[model samples]
Target: MITLKFKKFNIEAYKPGKSRVKKLRKVIKLSANESALGLSPKVKRLISNKKLILDKYPDGKSKDLRKAISKTYNCNFEKIICGAGSDEVIQMICQLFLNPKDEVVLPEYSFLMYRIYSKVVGAKVVFSKEINFKISIKEILKKVNKKTKIVFIANPNNPTGTYLTKKEVLELRKKLNKNILLVIDDAYAEYMKNSDYSSGLNLFKNKDNVFILRTFSKIFGLASLRVGWGYGSKKIIDRLNLIKPPFNVNRIAQLAAVEALKDKKFVNRSIKHNFFYANKIKKFLEKYNIFSNTVSANFLFLNFEKCRYSSNFFYQKLKSKGIILRSTKDGYHINNRLRLTIGSSKENLKFMNTVKGIFD
Candidate 1:
């Protein structure tokens, strides 16, 4: 047999939140930060009523979806590139920008994809320490050097549920070297209602050094569809297009995402639902001495330091009751904490009831 040899890299694969527990047929999953309201009515109707041409390939450029994004966000049409998910866009950015020995910097407890993709492309991943679970711009700046290629940050940061204000983010850009690329993921931007907050696309629309990633997964309720788009300068978009997989986003996902953008009512309703239940859950958890960050995104970073039980103890208890919450030990390496995704009204009620049963 011919010897099989290929390049190998030391990288830990991503472990998603547990979706099942043994012997549980009906489980309430609050692990993944998915849409609380499920799919938009427009998306559901489009999928059911619109006849699709299965044999033919979708538009490689995703023209209609891009148009919808441009119209919805009021951004330049030529500067957008659609991807299978923001994860794919992150991967492409690593591929396009990184070489062996380059550096990528991000918060230590932020989204795992940024570090994972950077490592896959032979880049050195630098971790910036956060201040009390919030990303520190000073710490990020300390890690930057000539070898740094990109800096990735998720606002209303995943898993932590804490965000930086508009002034703070603007300061970060102003202080950083102009040549370094700052990749901002706005996955939960639609869920934000804070007056001091602003999405990356809105802040960096004209900046060539900044790239913004937007997803239809959170408030738009289209995680299963797997369609996301990136915004950057036209030159960068043109270069990215050269390497983007022809027809990266499938036809069904594209159509669904476009329709999802048009349904502002559904988005607003989801936001309202998230705000109500997030505060409700946060306040309820406090009775048991488990605290969380201020309500910013669609989830809460539940800290068990002052609680009667440990994070793992609560996780196992929930699992036994056919409920699931994200364990910070999975890839985050964070101790004494769990990421609690805001769920539907019924799911949230069940979670609180289960917590009471265990504590009472």
Candidate 2:
């Protein structure tokens, strides 16, 4: 047999969240933290453009897409870079900054992709403890040292759905070494109505080391398109540009995202619906004795820690009934918790009723 070799087991493969199961006739998918209101109708209208050329190469820089994102968000156009998703942009950061033995700091239960990409680039991952399901600034500061090169914080953290206030974030920045890159992954930024939260874009003006990673997949309802963009200082932008793959973001995704940004009405509708139904689900769950920690994103992290049954048991039970919710096992590292994305009003009601049937 030919010898099989890898980088001596450099990385464990990533486990993406579960997709909606399709066997059942009626299904309510609240697993992935995707928009309860799907893709913008304007984006949907663009899908039938039959005259567009299919075989042409996309603009390698994705200039128009970047300009649209910049104009919509009041950001510097030249400073933004697009990727297949923010996930690819994140991996590029790892490749550009991480040496064979450098260390990257993260929240104890932040996004799982950060850990996976760090390991692939031969970097060590350091996790800071969370306080009451929020990323604790004190714990994160304590984890820093001479070896630390990057600190990845996913604001309104996935699975947990809690966020760090802007004051706490700026304080963390003041204490950390300026040499270390501070990456803010703001995937669910638009869904948040928290008045004290900022997206770290303003932080980039005064701080040489701040970088913001954002995704069209979340609030834009373009999850299927896999388009995302990043903001940073010119030096960081240049480095990432040189390292990213050619035509990394496809033409279709770029076009869809550009349109997604133009339609603020649809985005506002999604935000309103998410806000309304998410709280509705929260109250319903509380009535049935299920509770969650404070959440500021599009999902809920149900506290099942006190229950006799495992999270897996609840996951499988819901799966059997055609209601899909996320078990914390997708590498978020928070045991005894289940994350359920807020679906449409009808979907949310069905999910809650299904749970009541099981437990009540």
Candidate 3:
């Protein structure tokens, strides 16, 4: 048996939403931060057209889709690389950069994938302390040293939905050494309406050491397709390409993502719906004396401190009632908190009604 060295690392505990929902005949899943609005009709048609190409191998270079993304973002084609998902892109970055004992820095309460990938690459993972679920730049700066190879900042961070301001991002970028690779994971960038929110792509234009990561999973409603891309200087992109497997992304995913990018109407509608439903859920949570941060993303993090139930207990209770939510513990400490995905109006109402029953 070929055993991995880090076999002892405990897999992050995720709330068992899928298995729990299997037992419930009628389950409303609001756990994973997937877009509740379905994929665009154009993308569906593109997939239908590409079904015939399944017998052939995918384009090894993904040239056309790369061009599409490059054109959309107004960046050079040499600076972009597509992957199975943003997760795959992250893994590639780790493989290309991290040695056995190099250090990786990120916020304590951010996305779980950052930690998972760091360990997979045999890097020493150091977490900066979080303040109200947001990344504190001072804490991050304190943790940085000569050993730090890469630093990941998930803007509008997962679970918490907190983001860094443009000024904060620039300040951090300036303070970091030129050799350190700063990856700005903008997986939820599309949902942000604030003009001051740094997209990370701006850093790429100014600094050779910066890279911006994005995904089609959220705003484009193509989570199942798993299309992700990154933008950086040609040097960094070329380095990442060294470890990326040929044809890492599939044909259908490329086609769907290309079409989805062109579907501006669908993108607009999804953004509009996200803003509308997020406010509704916030108001509902407030009525129950439950407080949550006002996030500029498609998901809401509901802290259950006022309800007197542990997050795990509340998650189980919600699951039993046919409402699925994400629960975290151990490394991810939000006290008693549940991350809820904003869904369609009907789905949102169903989730709200189910929660109201629990509170009442």
Against the true structure, candidate 1 has what lDDT? 0.93
Tell me the tens digit of each residue's lDDT in model 3 across 1-360: 997774555356433325347566877778778887989989888778734578778886778899998888788888889998898888888888888779999898878777888887778899899897888989998999999999999988887888899999988888887899999999998899878886887556656788888999889988888889988888878888777898888989988888898999999999999998898889888887667777678898888778666678768877888887776553466667878889888889988888778778
Residue 61 of model 2 has an lDDT of 94
TM-score of 2: 0.95
- Give the residue spans of candidate 2 off by over 4 A: 20-26, 306-310
The candidates, ranked best first by lDDT, are 1, 2, 3
The models' CA-based lDDT, in order, is 0.93, 0.85, 0.83
TM-score of each: 0.98, 0.95, 0.93
Ranking by TM-score: 1, 2, 3
Q: Could you give me the TM-score of model 1 versus the true structure?
A: 0.98
TM-score of 3: 0.93
When 2 and 3 are scored with lDDT, the better candidate is 2
The residue pairs found clashing in candidate 1 are none
Q: Is candidate 1 or candidate 2 better by lDDT?
A: 1
| All candidates: CA RMSD (Å) | 1.0, 1.7, 2.3
